[model samples]
Target: MTYGKFAYVYDELMKDVPYDKWVDLVMKNTQKYNIQGKRLLDIACGTGELSIKFAKKGYHVTGVDLSEDMLMVAHSKAADNGMDIQFYQQNMAELEGLGQFDIIGIFCDSLNYLQSEQEVLDTFMHVYEHLDDKGLFIFDVHSIHKILQIFMNQTFTLNDEEISYIWNSYQGEFPNSVEHDLSFFVLDHKSGMYDRYDELHFQRTYPIEIYETWLREAGFEVVEVAADFESVSPQTQSERIIFICRKK
Candidate 1:
């Protein structure tokens, strides 16, 4: 589950991801819900993209990720930007040591990487333990339609003079899960050759009801469940589901 070489190339490949939308979601809900604290925790905050963005928005941001390589990149970026974000290498399910936060977010579909229901529930409970009273816990996951209909058995290719990639998706062992097999080729200018790297990653998601129930079971009150950053209930073909909850 290590990103290995993928850590360095992640930002370039994910340049089109809606990072601003996630930050907007937090600000919108914080204002709407009257959350005033500036302390924020970014779970699975790969390479600290959202963490740095949150910091820029005046949040006292702390980032946690399982991959040290990703955290290394994040730390360097934060230092370069003169940001004081605290980056920690830790698994979200077993997250500890860091104190409570006013807002805890698991962005970029990182929650989907959990392999089992127990781990998901454990993560929810741990997040509850680390949130201040009435703090917000926001996360998003890939909708089932996206996993089965849009991604399953799909092959995607990216071609560039400097970098190229071939990505394939297949059904995973767990229900509502998909495995991504990626091969990346980066051109070495000096050698006039390509250095190839391969990675396999698994992601799973469940019915929205299941996530809501888990949040409540972990002492949270469901504030909103929206699809694709819109404040509307999810429809049949929604690609992403977002959840916003408040610690009770």
Candidate 2:
């Protein structure tokens, strides 16, 4: 998936996303697990949105992503905000060189982008390798219910003065996967015209049990599993599954 232009409009389209809920989740879980260190590694940290948030909260943040374009946007945002954050271009599955951190996050269901079970397992092992002995691994993913019941074969649209997009979701070749074909229109003030672009995004998710097993194989002890930012158990239709784990 190319994020050349999507990187620029991501934050604008995701303005309604409850980023702070992630912040609160991290803080509450870290405190609950008795982790007091501030260093954090944000994997697949697109545009550094949550990385910057963690930095503002006094965490020593390092952000990693697969897209150089996304890292560029993140770097610009960090510099503009006067926040000191380290941004790197690296795929989450092949993450390396970055040392252990007090906390590691793969938020925004970014893991769903991994195309294979081995990639997901590799990511879990890498996260285990790069986590402090007492650190926490916090991440979330689209639940099976959400992928099948909510996103499958859906068409979504947004029309605005500055930007607009038509998103079509259909079944992917892989099981429990969704492919999103998007066409975007952006108004240009310089010439009073609209620039059109297209991008395809692929996302797939597995059952929570599959993820739990991978976590164990990667030498992690599952601490908790939550749903939709709630502290209770995941219901039949919960859209998101959050995993809390520590180094085994």
Candidate 3:
């Protein structure tokens, strides 16, 4: 329920996400797979960015996240944009009674926040239960390559008028895991003062084959695995990986 300041500044920091590409991919795959109805549940749908996009595109979209702070931001954005999106505060690992959907998405590297493989398997099982037969499940994850090559022992900073962030990534004790130490300096527009806040997030990724195996165990038919946002062959040295799966 507490996202601290990470939920508040999440959108600003992730302004570069290629949401249009995700939408395009969803549309194309849904059509190709004959997923007709528009019911969709976006797990860990931070701020409802892509959820609202689907709503605008005529999907009955529901967005769920663990952070009430993030859902508040998502609600405000939906109101501002005049989009009707149902945003729920819920954990993805144990999604319950969330009815069936023709499409389910877990994008934006949100799955990276899970700290363990058990959590991942539980989440996959929950998604399988909520998906209609042959429903499409599309998501993306931070590749192991990214954890080692890009984030390992990395220090990065972002500066802007409304918010500033210093992010440091360290190798986790376990293989294929990374820990993020984030400090934020957010400006209060009315008070003209900056408040400092901090959050620590842990992430780990298994091999691609592991995910495929788990998806199959969860009753999903594994489909294609593509690099990050690319549709075809992966670009050399890709840092992100995408999975397009279907319910069996």
> Candidate 2, which segments miss by more than 4 Å at Cα?
none
Off by over 4 Å in 1: none
Report the C-alpha lDDT of model 2 over 81-151, residue by residue, as the tens digit.
Answer: 99999998888999999988999999999999999999999999999999999799999999989989998
TM-score of each: 0.99, 0.99, 0.95
Question: Compared with the true structure, what per-residue lDDT tens digits does model 3 show for residues 1-248?
Answer: 24777887888888898888888889988888888889999898888889888888888999999988889999999999998888888789989988999999998788988888899999999999999988999988888889888999999998888888899999997789999898999998889999999898888887888999999999988788889676764444787888999998
TM-score of 3: 0.95
Best by lDDT: 1
lDDT of 3: 0.87
Residue-by-residue lDDT tens digits, candidate 1, 183-243: 9998989999999999999999999989988888999999899999999999999999999
Candidate 3 residues lying further than 4 Å off, grouped into runs, are 233-236
- Which pairs of residues collide in candidate 3? none
User: Which has the better lDDT: candidate 2, or candidate 3?
Assistant: 2
* Residue 111 displacement in candidate 3 (angstroms): 0.9
Q: Count the backbone clashes (under 3 Å) in each candidate.
A: 0, 0, 0
Q: Which is the winner by lDDT between candidate 1 and candidate 2? A: 1
Candidate models: Cα lDDT each: 0.94, 0.93, 0.87
Q: How high is the lDDT of residue 45 in model 3? A: 84
